[model samples]
Target: MKVLLLGSGGREHALAWKLAQSPRLTTLFALPGNPGIARYARCLEGIPLTDHDAIVTVCGAEDIDLVVVGPEAPLVDGIADRLTAEGIPVFGPKQVAAQLEGSKLFTKELCKAHNIPTAAFGRFAEPAGARAFIEAQGAPIVLKADGLMAGKGVIVAMTLDEALAAVDEVFAMGVPGTEILIEEFLEGEEVSFFCLVDGETVLPFGSAQDHKRAFDGDQGPNTGGMGAYSPAPVFTPEIERRTLAEIVKPTARALADAEAEFRGVLFAGLMITSAGPKLIEYNVRFGDPECQVLLRRLDGDLLALLEATANGRLAGHDVTFRDDAALAIVMATRGYPGDYGKGSVIAGLDEADAVEGVTVFHAGTRLIGDRLTAHGGRVLNITALGTDVREARARAYEAVSLIDWPEGFCRTDIAWRALKL
Candidate 1:
């Protein structure tokens, strides 16, 4: 099958890598794909994802069988709806359904109305109301901007001053009619649960734990994700059962009832609390760094599964993952999740991938002549597979050591929760 994958991040590179391995895949193409993705698919550079008409033209020219969206922005922007209108099959939720990620208040309200377990939240259109709510909520509260901020919009304020300041900061961005969501911070271990929903059928698609903090020991500010490991040890069978029954299934049912039937992946950000698994938030597509590991352990035909989901033929289909564990360590420009310089020459990628069970997925990189240079934060994902999380972590770090980029840095402890190291 001919496929056109969207986005230009490590997640898209992983998807391209997996799709390229499928025997049924005839041609794989990527839009503004990274250097790592270019190895597996034809990279169509220059066309922005926002140009929906251009994407449709590419699909028609290539006779694309499926268009798999790797990022949430396009889906939230109604790219799937536009493609479907042109009779193109897309593996992503439409605009209405994508509100689950586009707006934090939307998910919170859905949880409240459906009785789905989640943190108590209050939405405010103005700053005074948000500040008043924050004062009432006290310290250790969570403040989230209504729209997307590339995963850095939410702030876990540990003090009253911080909480109030966060509100001001969000409003200072000056997005017209911007709303802030103040949520009661729930204490627990967080895990990402994924499922493929083709309007009605919900197929479990494995789980992973993401390191949102940029530094080791879970310190520093939140980022897109520094690193991740698949088959989260904390997400046990019992927890999985409760999550699906109480959260995932109910969410799908509620969306269906609301006439916003969803297709494609539902990435649930869950907090395993004393009561049970509670909804933290949701992403319409796959998670970066997390996807790098999950796809490394998948043991099925990715192209076929996605095509089936796009066509609404996922009723009886299920995916299988290798028993082996997969871990990914994100190597970023030294000042990542903040201001970082670009165009720093990087070397030794070939040697890093030569490490047994290791594959380095590029994120913010560009191949300049014969040199690979950093172009963005969270530049490379050194992913590896092993019998367990510990071995996977070792292999991933080993690959990290081989990379010759002085400007890059990665967290030394990726699966610390699982290994307790």
Candidate 2:
């Protein structure tokens, strides 16, 4: 089967890698793909993703059988709806369903209306109203932009000053628009749970713990993802069962009841606390570095699974996983999630991949002639799989140590909480 994968990140790279391994795959193509993904798929450039006509033309020319969107931006922009309208089999939710990630306010309301377990939140369109609510909510509240801000929209404010500052920063910055959400902070360990839902059937994928902090010891500003490890120790079998019963199932049912019938990946960001697993937020697409690690652990035919979900036959498909754990450490350009330089030549990638079980997936990198250089905030995702989290961490870091890129940095402890156990 011919496949056209979208986006140019570590998630797309990993998806390309996994999809390429499928025996059913006859051809693979990535739009605006990075240098790393070029190894497994034919990288195409100059195709404007926002242009639905251009995308349709490319799909027709390439004879692409399946279209897999990796990022939330294009999905929220109605890429899937456009493609599906042309009878193209696309693996992503439609634009209406994408509102789950595009607008925090919409998701909060959906959860409230459906009685889904989530933090109490209030939407504010004016700064004055937001400030007044923050004052009443007290410290340690979660302030978020209603619209997407590339994963940096939400702030877990620990103080009243921080909460108020975040409100001003998001609104005054004029980046997140006029709306913001003030949510009651929930105490718990965060876990990313993914599922493949085809209208009614929900197939559980693996879970991972994402380190959002840019620095080690969990101290820094939030990033798209610094690093991640799969088969999260926190999400044990028992917790998985409870989460599915009390959280995931309810969410899927709620969306169905609302006539969304969410298809493609349903990423539920959960906080497991004394009160059990409560939804922090919902992402319509897959998580970046988490997808990198989870894809590394996937042992079945990815193409078949995706096709089943797209065809609304996921109930009959068997999605299996390997018992091994996987870890992905993201190598980011210096001063990421803010200002940073680009085009610095990177080296030692071959040496990094020489380590057993390590696969380096590119995120923000480009090939200039023969030299690989940085292009975005996060650059490379070095992912590894092993029998346990400790081995996976060791293998992943061993690869990181060999990489020679002074312009880049990564979190040394990717999944310390899970590995320590």
Candidate 3:
């Protein structure tokens, strides 16, 4: 079977690596894929990823059997809708259904309408209204932009001054002045839970804890994700059961009733609070860095699993994972999620990959002649698998140590919480 993967990042690179491993795959292509992805698939860099018509034409010309979307941007832009309209099987939700991630306000309203447990939130169209809500909600509030902001849209304001400033900053983005979400902050460790749903039956995939804060000890602005580890200790069996019953299932059911019939990976960002697992937000696609570690632990044919979910025949199929733990350390350009230089030559990738159980997934990189240069904020992800979190974390860091990039920086503590066990 031929497949076409979408997006260009560590997540798509991991997906490409896993999909290429499937014996059933005969050919693979990536749309605007990065240098790392080029090793495993034919990358079409000339065409833009968001050009739906061009992508549909490529699928037709290449005789693509399945289209797997890796990022929320294209899916939210309705690329899946165009592909499915042309009779191509897509492993992503339609644009209408993708509002689950496209709009923070939309999901919050959905949770309220369906009685899904989430942080209390209020939508605002004016700065005054938002400020008023923040004043009422008090400090330590969570403020989010209505639409996607490259994962940096949400801000946790710990003080009234910060809350007011956040409101001004979000409004100043030139986004719809009326587009913002002010909610009461929910305290606890956050977990990234992935579920494959076919608008009917749901298939549980796996879970990972994502470190959103950019610096060590969780004190800094949020990037897409700094690092991650799988099988989060906080999301126990009981908590998983409760999350599915109270959050995942209900949301799926609600989407179905609303005629959305979600057909893709439901990335439920949850907060394990004192009450239970509460929904923080949804991504509607795989999480970067998390995908690097999660796919490393997967123990089945990824192609078959995705096809089943796309075809809505998940009843007979089951997804499994290795007992071993996995960890991913993100090696990013210095001063990431802010002003930073690009095109710095990167070195020692082979040495990094030579480390046992480590696979380096590229994010923001480009091949200039023979040299690999940094191209984005988060550059490469060094992921590893081991008997436990400690080993996995050690292997991941050891590989990080091998990379020779003076312009790059990474957190020394990737999975600090899980290393305790």
Candidate 4:
């Protein structure tokens, strides 16, 4: 089957790599793909992903059988709806279903109404109202922008001053924060749990832990993702059962009850607190570095699984994952999630891939003649799979060490939490 994958990031590159391995795939194409993805699929440049008419034209011209969206922006913009309207098969949530990630306030309200386990929050459109609520709630509150901020919308304030300042930054500073949701910060360890839901039934995928902070030891401002590792040690079997019963299934059913039949990857960012597991947030699509790790450990035909979800036949399909653990360390430009230089030449890609079980998926990189150079915030995702997390971490860093990009840097302890345990 011919497939057209969307987005230009490491997640898309990893998807392209995994999809390319499927024997069921006859042809695969990526729209404006990065240099890393070019090795596996035909890169179609100059076509705007937001342009529904143009994409439809290309889908017709290329005889594309399936369209898979890799980013949340396009999904929030209703690209899937447009494509499906044209009789095209797309693997993403519709705009109505996408509100789970598009608007923080919307999801919080839905959770409250449905009794879904989540942090207590108050939504405000005006700064005065938000400040008043913050004053009542006191310190250590979580302030989040209503709309998407590329994984940087949410702020965990440790003090009252910081909480108020975060509200001001999102509301008064006009940083794409017209509305904000301030929630009571829950103290706990966090884990990312994913599930493929087809409105009626849900199939839980493996768990992964992502480093949202830009630096090591969980310091610095949040980026898209610093790194990630799969089969999170924190998400034990009992925790998984409770998460699916109390969080994942309830959220999926809640969306359906609200007349939004969600179909696609449902990413639940959960906090396992002393009280219980609470929802941190929800993502409509696959997580970037998380996708790199999960895809690396995936052992089945991805194309078939996606098709089943898109076709609402997920109940008949059971997704399998390898028992081995996978770790992905992200290599980013020096000053990422902030101002940073670009076009610095990168080297040692082949050597990095040569490491047993290691796969380097390109993110913010491009080919300038014969050299690959940095172009975005998070540049490369070096993923490795092993019988254990320790081995996986060792192999991942070993591969990352071989890369000779002076302008790039990565966290030395990508899976430190798991390793420490």
Candidate 5:
């Protein structure tokens, strides 16, 4: 099958790599792909994902069999709806269904209406109301922007001053009628639970835990992700059962009832509190560093699974995962989640990839005349597979040590929670 994968990040590189391994794949193409993804698929450079007409033209010219969207922005922008209108099978949800991630208010309302387990939240259309709500809720509350902010919108304010400031900052974006969502903070271990949904069927894909903090010991500002490990130690069988029964299944049923049948991966960010798993948030697509590790532990054909999902034939198929653990440590340009320089030459990638069971997936990088240079904040994902989290962490860091990028840095202690457990 000929496929057109979207996005230009580590997640897309990992998806391209795994899809390229499928024997059923006749051809693979990527739009605005990174250097690492270019190795596995034909990179269609300079084609912006927002260009729906150009994407359709490319699909027609290539007779693309499937268009797998790796990022949520395109899906939330109705790219899948566009492709489906042209009779092309696309692996993603339509704009209405994608509102689960695009609009925090929408998800909260859905959870409230459907009784899906989630934290208590209030929606405010004005800054004064939001500040009042924050003051009433006290400290340690989560303040989220109603719309997407590339995973940095939500601020877990530990103090009253911080919470009030976050509200001001969110309103300062200047989008009129922008709603601020203040959620009651719940303390627990968080895990990323992913499932493949084809409108009717919800297939359990896998589980992973990612470090959201940018620095070691879980200190520093929240980044896209610092590192991740598969089969989260805290997401046990019973907890998985509760999550599916109380949260995932109810969500799928609710969306279907609303006539917005979802088709793609539903990434549920859950907090395993003392009561049970509660929804933290949702991402319409797979998580970045989390996807890197999940793909490593997958034991079946990814292309076929995605095709099945797009066609709504996922009811009978089941996913399989390897027993071994996989870990990914993100290497970022120094001073990430903040201002940072770019165009720094990076070297020793081949040596790093040569490490046993290690593959460096590029996130923000450019190949400038045989020179790999830093192009974004979060750059390379050093992913490795091992018998356990400890071994995987070791291999991933070993590869990190080999990379000769002076401007890059990564957390030394990944999988710290699992190791402690």
Candidate 6:
């Protein structure tokens, strides 16, 4: 099968790598892919991701058997709708369905209407209204920008002053125009639960614990993702079962009832509290570093699964993962989640990948002659597989240590929680 994968990030790189391993794959193309992805698939350059017309044209020209979207931004921008409208099958939800991630308020409303378990939230269109709600909710509340801010939208405030400050900051993004979401704080460990939905059938794809904070010990500002480990220990078999039955099932039913009928990966940001699992948020596509770890542990014909989902054949198939744990440590530009220099030459990738059970997935990297240069905040995802998370994490960091990029940084504790177990 000929495949066209979209996006230019570590997630796409991992997807491309896995898809390339399928014997059924005849040719693989990554649209404007990065350096690492280019090794596994032919990278289509110059065409912007938003150019649906160009993508559809290429799909026809390349006789692409399937189009898999790797990021939420394009999916939320209606790229899937456009591709499907052009008679090309796409593995992504439409714009309206993608509101699950595009607009925080939209998901909150969906949860309320469907009786889904989530934090009690209030939506506001003005700063003052948001401030009043923050005061009413008191300290240890949550503040979120109603619109997507690339995973930096939500803020967990531990005090009243911080809560008010978060509102002010979000509102300062714009007043009446700025949308705000203030919700009751649910204290607990967080895990990412992902499922693939082909309208009717919901298949549990994978699970991972993502470190969203920029630094170790969760002490820094939010980032796209600093690192991650797969098959989170906190999300045990029972939790997975309950998550599917209580959260994933109902959301799929609600989407079907609403005639949305999801067609791609649904990432649920979950808070596993004493009260069980509650929704923290949702992402219409796979998580970054989490995707790196999950894909490393995915042990089946990935192409077959993607094709099945895209063609609505999910009911006949079950998503599978290796029992072994996997971990991904993100190597970032020195000042990542903030300002950082770009185009610094990177080295030692070959040595890094030579480490047993390790693979380096590129993000924000470009091949400039014989050198790979950093081109974005999150630069590389060093993923490793092992019998347990501790071993996996050790292997991942070992590979990370091999990388020779002075201008890059990584969180040393990628799976500290699971490691503690």
Query: For residues 73-104, could you state the per-residue lDDT of candidate 4 as single tens digits?
Result: 89999998999999988899999999999888
Question: Which residue pairs collide in model 2, if any?
Answer: none
lDDT of 1 at 44: 96
Candidate 3 structure lDDT: 0.90
Cα deviation in Å at residue 119, candidate 2? Answer: 0.6
TM-scores for every predicted model: 0.98, 0.97, 0.98, 0.97, 0.98, 0.98
For residue 196, give model 3's deviation from the true position in Å. Answer: 0.5
- What lDDT would each prediction earn against the true structure? 0.92, 0.88, 0.90, 0.89, 0.93, 0.89
TM-score head-to-head 2 vs 3, winner? 3
Residues 1-421 of candidate 3: C-alpha lDDT, one tens digit per residue: 9999998999999999999999999999998889989999999878887788999999989999999999999988999899999999999999988999998888989999999999998888889999988887799998888787778988888999999988878876537554788888999888999999998988888999988888998888899999999989888999989999999999999999988989999999999999999999998999998888889999989999899888888888888899999999998899998999989999999999999999999999999998999999999999999999999988988898889999999888788877642
Better of 4 and 5 by lDDT: 5
Query: Where does candidate 3 clash, by residue pair?
Result: 125-178
Query: Quick one: best lDDT, which candidate?
Result: 5
Model 4 residue runs over 4 Å out of place are 172-177
Expressed as tens digits, the lDDT of each residue in 174-250 for candidate 2 is 35456778899999899999999898898889899999999999888999999999888788788778878877777
Q: Candidate 5, TM-score vs. the true structure? A: 0.98
RMSD of model 4, in Å? 1.3
Candidate 4, poorest ten consecutive residues by summed lDDT: 170-179
Residue-level lDDT of model 5, residues 215-325, one tens digit each, is 989898888999999989999999989998998889889889989999999999999999999999999999999999999999989999999999999988989999999
Q: Kindly provide the TM-score of model 4 when superposed on the true structure, using C-alpha atoms.
A: 0.97
lDDT tens digits by residue: candidate 6, 122-230: 9888778888888877989888876668887778899999888787787754335757888899989999999999989999988999999998888899999999998
Q: Identify the runs in model 2 with alpha carbons over 4 angstroms from their true place.
A: 173-177
